[model samples]
Target: MGLRLACRPLKPIDARRAREYAKHAMPSVHLTRHLYTFFPHLEGQHLIVEASTAGEVVAALEKLAPGIGFYICDERGRLRTHVNIFVGKQMIRDRKGLTDAVAADDEVHILQALSGG
Candidate 1:
């Protein structure tokens, strides 16, 4: 499913508000890698996408590799425990909701978190 934003004529005040909103919105984000085990076809390639949120970025990735999202996340749309997603230097706070904010220059890294006994 996709979301379509309806275009409408804006009044002077609304237009100003829209401009302000656009200023805060990031234009794009970079995906460093798509973990080989999960996305073999896109393993080494770095993908640049236009998305404001982490979820949107994953959705864009799904377009490139079908069922990719399922591998990274569960049926409830939560990030798997073994999967680690970082937007820039900090790890995302809401793993389950994926409501983390992402910027245009931010590097989004998705990789498997390894552990040993």
Candidate 2:
């Protein structure tokens, strides 16, 4: 099941209600434990997101947790070098634009790669 919010024009959303609505309706995002340390509020959240594309999923998550999108994606909105997002068991193909398709029931996993000696 999917519901599309009526998108407004290019106007910035300064309205609090609109933001709250998005938050209330947002699907819980499941990330790696490493990420949970950064956003403790997201710990143990479900792994579902409602969106057609991987990009939209990221956008929805950005609405829920501020700065999360940037942590997963670069300023240009491309997947970061150390971040990995999978639509399911398969990794996304379009890392640059995150245009990979995602169904409503699909589980999106976002993980940050750990590097150490």
Model 1 accuracy (lDDT, Cα): 0.75
Each prediction's TM-score against the native?
Answer: 0.66, 0.72
TM-score of 2: 0.72
Note the clash tally of each candidate: 0, 0
Off by over 4 Å in 2: 1-28
Give residue 10's error in model 1 in angstroms. Answer: 39
Q: What is the lDDT of residue 113 in candidate 1?
A: 64
Candidate 2 local lDDT, 4-114, one digit each (tens): 899778977678977676655533356888877777887766645668888998888877788888899998999999988887788998999999987655678888898
- Best candidate according to TM-score: 2
Taking the tens digit of each residue's C-alpha lDDT, what string does model 1 give over 44-77?
5657777767887787888988997887789999
In candidate 1, stretches whose alpha carbon ends up further than 4 angstroms from where it belongs are: 1-34
Q: In model 1, what is the error at residue 26, expressed in angstroms?
A: 7.4
| Each prediction's whole-model lDDT (CA) | 0.75, 0.80
